[model samples]
Target chain A: MILKKLFSRRKEEYWWMTIAVPLVAILLALITGVIFIKATGRSPLKAYKLLFGSSGLFPSPYWKNHFAEMLLSSSMFISTGLAFSIAFKGGLFSIGAEGQFIVGGIVAAYFGYAEPFAGLPTILHLIIIFIMAMAAGGIWGAIAGWLKTKKGIHEVITTIMLNWIALYLIEDWLVTGPMKANISTGISGTPYISATAKLPNILPGTRLNISFIIIAAAVFFTWFLLYRTTIGFEIRAMGYTLVFGMEAPKASGVNVNRRIIQTMFISGAVASLGGSFIVLGILFQYPPVFEGGYGFDGIAVALIGQNEPVGIFLAGILIGALRTGATSVQLAHIPKTFPSIIEGLIVAFIALQELIRYLIMKLIVPKRSKSD
Target chain B: MDNTSLLNSSLTQTMDYAAPILFAALGGVMSENAGVFNIALEGIMRFAAFFGVWGAYISGTPWIGLLWGIGIGIVIGSLHAYITVKWAGDQIVSGVAINVMSMGIITYLLELIFKTTGYSPPVPYFGSSVNRIHIVFIENIPFLGAFSNLTILVWFAIILTVLMHFMLYRTVFGLRIRSVGENPYAAETLGINVVRIKWFAVIMGSIFAAFGGMALSLGTLSSFTNAMANGKGFIGLAAMIFGKWTPFGAMAASLLFASAQVIQLLLQVAASGFAKLIPLGFYLALPYILTIGALIGVVGRAVPPAADGEPYKKE
Candidate 1:
């Protein structure tokens, strides 16, 4: 009864809850890593170093390559993270970023090698491909949004089903049939993209390309649109009120269906750009088994960052750095999957924030509130 | 072969594929009936697939593997129940966490135990011919021959479907679960133990999902691959929705979805010219496409339990 009374007082819960969520997440992740690191017969200190060495925090000899890898991978994460964050802000859990990314990659890769675009100026060719990829991706994302808005089908089911469709469409149909490269070797992929369509490498001897610059601009654009604009306000409002069933809340300045579609469009375009970077910057062509991992991981990045633009950028870097570091840790005889465990634990802790708040409230508020 | 034999082969294959999906759809039905939205069915199946293999590998007994699968299901189910029921956690977030963790954890465990990355070596399995239940009378029957040489796991799946149908529609416990799902406060007022009921439903649901995973590894194949249970769990979820969350309905849905695979295989075997006319990807994507179509067709018509996915707290 005392616990129930303490819990009923909402103000007390938020006081410690704000401080505890992030603190507990980090602590729990650290404990998990330490336990697994110990299981591998390694000291936690060295294991952390090896695991984080890819972030270039330590002045190791191969730090340059490691750091560059972290930055390059982070560009993809940040872009996809932005994709998830935007839709999330619009009160939609759209996991179609995976499919959107593939759509963009397929478009970008195709246009990069298309015959009609041959001998065009580098900038013009790149511009055409970029626009095409974004359009393709936007359409892909909008399909789920359209289904949700018009057909009343849930976005989660549609997005997951779309993901599988995209996977098979690319792998089993397109790559194997129409778009299969005209090469005799066993390699299953499209033809190499022309150098003119590629994103120029920014750092010397590193894979870090102008993709990072593009993603940085995207981050700013997302922040500006979300925080400063009227459209963004309506989107955020829609999230809070979730007035999708209503035709249009004109008084509240929100068109629910239109906002849903627009949010998904922007989210898909951003995620598609992330995938295009792989084609234009790294792969230079779509691989047959371009089965995406980063796209799905974007959900984690978005949630971990709490769906904020800057938070996504930071979380992207953290996850990208860990992914890069996992290989080095694997060489040290530790399970590379340890990072995933930490990622899962972090999300789990965040999901259980309410329970954490209740426990913290019980500890800190019960005695003080007893007088009431 | 001849037409009857061809039809029989397709029927048998359909049954093989449908069993796993049926098991998972049944799991979803049970949990959702008690007001828990358990998307972690996929993750539970993945974890169970690996543990089933590990258990069998260590003990040289498939029974131990089945036990292992059930044990892990109970443990993961409790974790999910604790988060969603006890703490009022976001169901989607918790489900995503379990899935992501399962992907990495299973891969790591596979390497640690088997010293292989892609798949485990073949072990004692239920799918092996000697372990199959041979119904002598049905052995020579044409279409019925499909059920003649079936594994114990497949029989369990078919039996459980009927059991679940009866359990959900005919029993008082089923009514209580449905009532709790519909209105937890009302059920509480009627002296029903909502928490305990939710816990039981979730755990049983997870065990059913684990059975699906076992069907993937131990029932269909003698080995556990990293890709075991692939998108089958999600497909099962689709079946659950398409079936409108009933056991017999889910069974019909699973069979319908699984028939796509059967048709694809049959098409390949029948005429090379015709099979080549259609892209292989179409066959592969048929079930998913059907899923979306089915969902779109049924939207707003098939309603869920009134209080489904809502956290119930005492006033």
Candidate 2:
């Protein structure tokens, strides 16, 4: 009788299990963090207290500041994560987001710092930079897309290599060439964006800017595109089945090559747009390290979110909070890398947790006959 | 071209630039043949470059220090294997993890061990000069003599290529390893210990990757620097892919990419005053641009191994 009841609840419990897995992963990561703290000769409780205590991450003022900063950072992460997720969902790995992101910043910065037309207003300048940056990233991304579709070049290998090209190109041009900072010797960065191009702060004296609203708009647009558009449907179809036989489209009859290329183009544009936000909104200038490790972190965000837009946003916030709080821990005398270790543990657990659940099910679930 | 200029150009330009990538590409072939996706080649090489110089500096023997790099490569490569192969984890993630770990470890150790960050303590005679072999036959041959000032390692690379070609096509073990990559299930059904063979192939590749790293630090640069491997590992992967996963193909790709690198360096040197106009970021990005262009020309027609990144387990 209990078995019957449990079997009846199984369908509903599946959703619960999905939630349970991340919860379990988080719990396991915390446990691992304790071990890590002890191994490093720090008090785990003290560290935990600092992270969870008053004036740390959880209280009202701290929470507000933390949430606002995390939201700002999460907006950037989600944009890039969406870029990766869309490509991964379509069965293509766009590891070149880093390159696209950099190009976007370069293009945006080039425009932002350049002399505006005699009659053009600051808002117009901002718009031009945004549009140019997105277009530049899109074009950069499209090269790989075009190659993938026409020549069947794998995106993974191409993107990784392109990242280097982008890096060296930026460093060389910014440090020595036309855009080289005339004020600083041997430094590779452009001049600060025009004051008119700067993103207005939502709150006084904080880094949060108008870019957060743009990120929200982007999320909504992506969600709408994925769920409501004919092209999005075609892209998803092509993603599911690349080919069944030679020289022909399979079911849904979408042109697989065109869809793949288009998806990559959009992916690249989104990533580049994120870069523009960081440059125009946050940093106000393009520095080498300003690009940060957002690209790889996007992969983690995508995985955690299961490639869903809302899930991705939430995951990015969680990651951003961890990042912000992690620095606070460092100030509290703990090593700075503890957060990354925690994140690695979370990813490892999430990746492997399904296998563990399967084993438990196989061992514990009773076999039933159809005749019964 | 005159024989002397050709010889000088090949000696001073081509082979000098090609060694590290060629070694790394060869390692990729071995790993791919055994069904291991060797994206960690860059991380492995970087780790070796840093640690090899550290070892040489501490132990006072460059050769012994180079061997210590090989040891570190094996340890880290095996850790990658454990995560991706044994744990059934994602290969890309594992590769990324290895890269992140390598960057962190090298930076931390450089700070901890040498009390220096970004660069290492300079060891005397570290990768400074090379001895060339000039034979009467070089004068006799038209094109071959231009590459006369070839380092000992460059010769080893060419010999390794010939040896690899022989082993891959001629040996029974090579055939088995190839089969394992192609169809591990079928190979397993036929009594091959797929797991063990893969582990061996991976470890062997690690040794080569280590040598590539050592070559970077000990043969090219006198002291180690953080992120020194740059994107050589990825460039090597491009070579492997562009070479259609064959040793000769990889060598050709490596040489082509290295030639581009040499050209970029030469251009940078020749026009240092006009550097800003050149868009150096784009120049440093030449290998990627060229590789993509080349791959786009040929990738659609080629085929990789059936189970390149898929982990296998005996159910």
Candidate 3:
């Protein structure tokens, strides 16, 4: 009877465990940070005070300026996160996000600066740039996806390789080709875009602009497509298992594999939009380093968010805060690398959260009686 | 048709350029055969390249530099083995972490030690002058003349290929290693120490991958750069996969990609009237594009080892 009762309780417990685990993990990280601070001879309390305390709190003028930078940072991350989330949900780990983002960014830079159609209206130019970026990123992503789907090429290998190709292509393009800037300096980047193509700021002094709004729309659309559509359902279903029989989606007359391809394509398109946003909204030029590691960070963001849209939005903000606050903490004498350390720990903790919980349950729960 | 001249020149460049990838791909084959997905080959190569060149700069000897490169690879590979194999961490994530961490470590170390971001300029480094092979008889032979003079390591790789072929396909230990890859559970039941084999494969793989990096830093470039391994690790992985995971096949695949790269370079040089139409951007992406294309083109499946990335546990 106790066993049955315990079993029944598990369902309820699990509902809470899902939320509790990630939250608890963050708490663990913060506590660990305390230990780190103590070891460094700084008061843990003082460090925390500076890291996320009242002065660093958002909405104030000082916080406002930093918050804008965070948005710019998270703007790229959110787009990449959405990209990872989309493909991951469809049972594909598109590790080529870095490559796709770079290709997209470089191509968009070309469009933004090198076109004879520079005299076009701002909105039209933006549309053209967005389309080109999306196409470039999509094509890059589709190569990996196509390789996986067609040749059984493990995407993990192909995507990583494609990243190198993307890097070289960008570097080579910037140095001696169509998009080369006319500077004598030994830097690899394109000429700056026409002013009209740049994202105008909402707050005038801040970097927060049309790109943030575009990313917001993309997130909303991703949520709608994933949860509220038949296509999403099919894609998610295919991801669950390949063994199809009586209970298969084919029984419901839906083609699951097709949905998988469609979803990845959409994922690529969304990620590409992020590349466009970065170029059009902020950077205004394609520097090799501008690709950064946003796509890589996106994977961590998606995981921590548990692949939910609202969760992603909140997680994006949390990550934004870390990116923002890490600098503040550094300015206050804490190590600047702490944020990355925390980020790494959070990802590790979450990825292994299930196993940890299972271990805990095994330890805490008593053995069943013979009668039960 | 003067096919001899083209073949002769292409052969020489392939040996020089393909050496790094050949070593790395061979290592990948061993690790994959032993059921460990060695995706951190890129990072391993980079770490080795950086440290290998640094050691040369500090120790004033290329041999010591090469050994240091190998040692660095062993440490990085062991960490990869411990985390992914022992802790059962996600292989992909761990591999990426190693890559990221190595990049930071190398960057920081470069700044602290060398006070530079990437390239350490060519110091007075020394390695075996196996840079040229003067096989007197072959040097006098008709079309085979130019092929005689190549790096000694090129010959070493060819011999190693045969040696590996015998070791992997002919020996009892090789059979056990293959069994471990096919099914660790069955191998364990049959009394093979699967964990030990995996560790052996990873460490051995690391040593070879390190040599690949050394080839870049010591053999080809005579210097080190940040992220110097570039995509050679991925190229090695591609070669491994494209070759269907066989040692010889993988070597051939590595050569194919390396040759594609050489061709791309040559095409850039000989950008004649018609060749000018091909954008340098597109041409540069040829090798990777072909890797993707090759993956799609091959109809017969290239299956990975059954337990390729899965950590074994005795349940």
Candidate 4:
């Protein structure tokens, strides 16, 4: 009964609660953000107006270009959010997605930039790079899974450690030592991938590319896999049941260990796709200090989305828009990290769902009793 | 320099580096021993470091800065305790939220206060040359004398480790905390206030973690840099695990990890041919790699408190 209360939906809950809860959380976060802006002696209204104006939510002359940039950013978030959600469904916290993402990008860049693959057709080249990236990420994630089962190591610790190791290895060794571009230039980054390996832009004169469609398809595939298939059922079962204890699943003869490894491999592969998008669609070459903190941001996305694929898609866009908009807050002398504070506040509020629910219950119960 | 002197110098560096990790790991032990999984150690330390610098810069005193840092830690700890203990929130999620929030809030505050994105200006630092104690007798000794000249924080960290070992194993409050962590229901039945104990444990742990941050901003450097805590908070968690969740064990584990870091630094400075043969990344990643290895090897032997991550409920 206690477990059910913890995991299962409350019977008295209304459908609007889902939408209302997140809406309330976002509203509160924005209010808190406004207070912060005011405390810093900035005009909160101007800051927010600039934020919305730049993000293209409000009518603006350059809204189209900003919207495209938002889409590009959201694509990575969507992919990484799905990656985290997949492992989360299987009762694993694969925080090492950042490492997997980095390794995957490195491998894809290697395959794309190598002279041996230059002669291949564009379609064939892209296919090979994607597969190799996923494969590398899968292997990376599988190590964490293997340690969990074989050595009883927790994925949290292993993944966190792996993240640092991956960062150092990529930054210090691979990019600088073995794979340094032949042409020494001002910037420290790999040579651009062959034109054939690049992701085609769907929109003319904008950053919008094939990644948008790919991320949309991934979202659909994740939803279909989790809610419409038997494997998904087993994975969800494993996640929820493991919370209570091992007796129920063990008695049912499920090979929990194998499932964990498989789930993590899939998780890592999905996260790798996010990195591939950045390399192929955005950067076209891996820079020495390429964008980071996206893997960590994905955790916030997954949590706000309630680990659901469709919800994650919306949350990803919301975060993407906020991040893109935050750049304009600097116009009002506010920091770009302003949106991050809002995002953090939302996550913190989400963590306090019980408190929110209790408050709502208190407000509703007295009214119902009076009516009775 | 001779090889022996080089080794001694490296060992001294190791002791210096170990102080911060040791403080943070001891904090982790305290909180985890009381059943709160404090992944927010990193965030807490970062927040404290920023506040430490801010306070010292404003007050022209490192002692005031240290107090300000601990005060912020206590506030954050209380907030975490209220959310997790009072509201029965998920511990890990709460921790992650705290970390995320700290990064954003600290960054925003940094820009607001310092008008810079990267780091703060130099501030009044704790343990200046005059205040730093150097034992003449110990300094005269050969290899083991490397620990003679040290910052006050290093000695404080050492003393706290021993103090914590006693606090966890010898006191009535310690027994209650252990009982609350192992089985809150039984502890409650025995008239122990699980909520109060957890609140005390978490707040105390946060204060200790603040000291770790102070060690970085005041003891080691006089300024706060963006993400200065780096991954030391996580390393402290690894140390807590590597030590089998014991205070002494965590301190020892921190020393081991710090030694790896010191060796890496020594390699860079010594300019040995062997150092050139190995990639810098290998040395940079050595401590984390060793941590993972230790966790895997010690899995069966080292165990956490029974109800580590679970939120306590009163029926």
Candidate 5:
């Protein structure tokens, strides 16, 4: 009876925790941004007003172009964020998400323009693109996973290597060479994908499209897979090896090696879907230069969101808003890079959050608490 | 095909590319040798490259810039050590945090100082002709001519490799350092101060990485771009693994990777016909492809230092 009560209470605690981590991080980031602006001899309030329109703070101005950009990017961020969170849950540091994202985009772009699966129904065409792109990403991710499980090679190094490989082979070479649009305009990018393959805009007068709905499904699918399945149980069991030292999981009959590869495959597929979203929903074509650091942003988002699927969805929107605000910081006569400083600071703070909380409680709050 | 010129370029330019990678790889060797999972070499190099340029621009000396780079490396390294070592935090998280912070912080400072986001102003740098140690007589020699007219930084890399090899393999203190990396508890029992060794190793690792950053800005380009030290640090990390975590082994691996890079350029320029028939991406992606292949089979299970990324705590 006591054990049941304890388990039930633990479940309840996560509801509050889902909100707390991002709240504290966002709060700390805003405070730091304010100090930085103040140090530069500018009114923090004025700069912020120019930053987030209707700067009253709930991430507003949904009718504007910026809000549309934020919503679109949030969809992208949430997708990649799911990738990282799933991989982390399986005890893999999969930085290959960037590469997987790129691969997925290219593969989707290829299928988007290619006529091999042509004349099919629109929904069928979309399904084919999703499968092909996600499979490409999965295969790419599995390389690193296989290296880790079979050869004891570090996944981080291999994944980084794979990222560079994708950059050179796919992004730089193939896209600019064979896949280049034949238009005499001399632009270096893949041909525009078919209109039938493109996701129709859902939000009238804004770029927001079917990606918003699709990404929501992805989050729900990942949450269900992680929390409501036996495979997820095995994956979580492997993850706990970080604390239990790899022995408990091994002894508990979890196939550690298989779990690593499976988890990374799922992670890679999700990241690739992010690429598909951009290609299908936003760009409708693969450009020569996609410096979208969405994969890296996923790392920050996953950490800030405490790795819950729903939490990641919220964190993605928050970060996407910051990114939109950053692009417009120039109107306030502040450098756009300023918002990036806050993003980086938030990551840095979370990495050492334990120490920060300790310092605050002991150094700043002790006197007031003692009086109470 | 201009075969001789291609061969000459590949042989000579190898060290030029290899020198920075060698410096960064040695940095990996130092820190991981002490069991600190220091993957912040890329971030440290980024910071140092910019600071070095600023220092040189102000003082009109690459040497002073190098000093500034070292100073910042010390601060960054100490920050890393504090979080991962002193605080017993997650090593990967700390490293990732530092890497993330460096990207924004450097860009912010670059805009603040230079009033430009693209690249810094050209400054006094060792890569200039006046500073190079020209081995004039070697020009008459066949392959040996490739080593002529190199920067002092290149020589530093070569010398440091030898010194690291000797220190790591031939000394008692080196044994203790390796022992700590392998098992800090065992080292502590043997009276070695695990924290002190870790501190020394992590700090020195940063200093070496700072030198690599200097090689990029102060040695090669004489100016720091926002893209300075692009992926060199990670390549160095790959070199450390490919070398099986030894000084001389890392030097060899750096040379091989550098040669691959040089061959790509040679193929692009000299073998244009071949380049067109195939694709430029094949050459550009060669090094990374080679890394994946090497990790898969050639190296055959390169194990890290036993206690590599663990945050050790005393009982």
Candidate 6:
């Protein structure tokens, strides 16, 4: 009877469950990570301490620069996380954020170095580059959307393929051929962007730049777009077809295909902004090799944030801290990839949330209520 | 070398490249045909590659290493099956999680065991145990000469392709798997053990994927490298789709992709001037571009199983 009751479905109207489940999942993941660390003959507590210390949570003078690094990293995550969140909310999976990011960065880099753009006013140059980057990313994303609408191809497959295409195209052709800088020395990557296009540093002696403000504005814009607009309502309706019924949207004459394309365009544009920030604010040029799985990391952030803009911002910061702290763990003779394992574990645990919810319900709801 | 010899060498290289992809694609066919989207093939293959090398290094036998790889594949497969089938979890999310976990765990193990992260030490080769057979007259043939010096895994992949074709099309068990995939409710109503069949198919597919990983690490390099699987599993998934989810069709697709890869390599080597004239990126991106084109071409007509990606619920 208890087993049957446990398996039975119950209404999940309580909002606390949403907050509690991810927290519990995170806790479980950390415990699992600790076990893995212990198995490696390392003190989990020390490793974690170092991780947080380097993340700038601790007021350690030795790791003074850690906070700046964490903020810088989180900026990219916040943008990409918003990118993923936007698409996910529209019921489209935009796995090509990685590709969009690359193209965005490369396009911005190209325009930043263009001779004509070099002489423009600083604000105009930055605006033009950002717009071009968004357009490039939007075009890339729109291709996947077009395929889904016209060809019935899954975005996941197309996006995955596009990522490799973007990587190879940049690495082999652009970086090695037309974009190659310092050709006499055979160095890879393009020339540095004009100083006018560069994002001004917000803090002296730190990498933090105006990109943080831009990202914060983007987050607010996304929230406004998703919640305070008619289009957003239609998109949400199309997304929650299971809840609202697919017929209602069709009956109301909301063009589903156009919505898919629009969502993907916005998704790609946001992700491209992340790439643009990386180039203008940090690298000042498109590098031959781009490290960090910003696109995939966005998926985790979006999921943990439950597709909320503010939530994604917080999740991005959390991930950024973990990534920054992981370097310290690496210095302590532990692999830097340990934080990724914890992230993966959290996702896995989240996947099992339904089971967890059932168990929780069983524990909390009285057995006497079985008659009801 | 003459043009014919060059062509022959390229064909041989294509076969070498195709073998691992063919194995993995066939695995994809098995799982997808049974209604499970095995997105964790990449992670499974990576884990197997590591274990294949580790087992050979420890046991001093390549065969044992192969077994170890398969064993690990089964474990991962069962976990995936349990999570998706029993728990009704999101397949893509779970698959991504597995991939992420595999990356971390494998890198951790690599550092812990070998004290290095780039590559593992070379392991024993299967060639030492099994002698190569030479058919001299046939080896002289122009294109066929490519088969002259090849690993046993290449032959295994080809033979398995044919065998899988028959097994999937002609077997009772295969019918049941298909039935479950197409309509689990109907299959269950007809007394078929849907969950059990799915578990079996997933496990079998994972084993095949592991062998593909082994072919990469053991068949060629005899060592494990980080990210050595290098999106071959995704390519295999692509091949599976391009093939319309058939064993023979997947083999043909794998061969086509392999040819594209070989042509790219040839461009880099034999025609450096031309390679430079046309950006190297175009060549590198050719196979994926072709796969995407193929997907676009076939999406409407090439229908997947009706129940594919849906979690089966028993009422």
User: Which candidate ranks first by DockQ, i.e. highest?
Assistant: 4
The candidate scoring highest on lDDT is 4
lDDT at A277 for candidate 3?
Answer: 76
Residue B53, model 5: lDDT of: 97
Q: Tell me the tens digit of each residue's lDDT in model 1 across B177-273.
A: 9998989999999999999999899899999999999999999988889887787887788778667788988898899878877776666656466
Docking class for model 5 is: medium
RMSD (CA, Å), candidate 1 to true, equals: 4.6
The order by descending TM-score is 4, 5, 1, 6, 2, 3
Candidate 4 vs. truth: CA RMSD?
3.1
* Candidate 6 lDDT score at position B137: 66
Instruction: Order the numbered candidates by DockQ, best leading.
Output: 4, 6, 1, 5, 2, 3
Off by over 4 Å in 6: A1-11, A57-64, A183-188, A227-230, A233-252, A365-372, B126-137, B270-276, B294-301
TM-score of chain A of 3: 0.84
Alpha carbon lDDT at A25, candidate 4 = 76
Lowest lDDT 10-residue stretch of candidate 5 chain B: B1-10
Query: Can you list each candidate's DockQ?
Result: 0.61, 0.37, 0.26, 0.65, 0.55, 0.61
Question: In candidate 2, which residue pairs clash?
Answer: A151-B300, A165-B285, A168-B281, A169-B281, A169-B282, A170-B281, A176-B276, A177-B276, B6-B146, B7-B146
Tens-digit lDDT track of model 3 for B1-315: 266656666776787778888888888888888888777777788888888888888887777887898899889778767756666666555565555445545654565567665678674343334444666566545557656776555666677778878888999998888888889999999989888888888888888888888878887677888758876877787678778778898888877777888888878887999888766677888877776666677635677777776666766
* Higher-DockQ candidate of 2 and 5: 5
For model 6, how does the per-residue alpha-carbon lDDT over A1-372 read when each residue is reduced to its tens digit? 642332232244654676667777788888988998998798999988888888865677745577777778888888888988898778776778888998899999999988999999999999999999999998888888888888877677678788899999998889777888977755568898999999888878878888888888999899888888977877777777723335677788988888788888989999999999999988988888887489887887777766778778777888888888888888778889888888788777777677767776788656637857
lDDT of 6 at B38: 79
Query: Residue by residue across B82-163, what tens digits does model 4's lDDT show?
Result: 8889998877777778888888888888888898997999998865776576876776466767777788888899999998
Stretches of candidate 5 off by over 4 Å are A1-22, A40-43, A54-64, A116-120, A184-187, A242-247, A359-372, B1-9, B272-275
* DockQ winner between candidates 2 and 3: 2
- Give the residue spans of candidate 4 off by over 4 A: A1-12, A184-187, A243-245, A364-372, B2-5, B297-302
Ten-residue segment with the worst summed lDDT in candidate 1 chain A?
Answer: A4-13
- TM-score each candidate: 0.91, 0.84, 0.80, 0.94, 0.91, 0.90
lDDT of 6 by residue, B63-90 (tens): 8898999999999888888877878776
RMSD to truth, every model: 4.6, 5.3, 5.9, 3.1, 3.5, 4.6
Question: In candidate 2, what are the lDDT values of residues B70-143, reduced to their tens digit?
Answer: 89989977876676666666666666556654654566467557767588987632345433444546653556
Candidate 1 interface RMS: 2.0
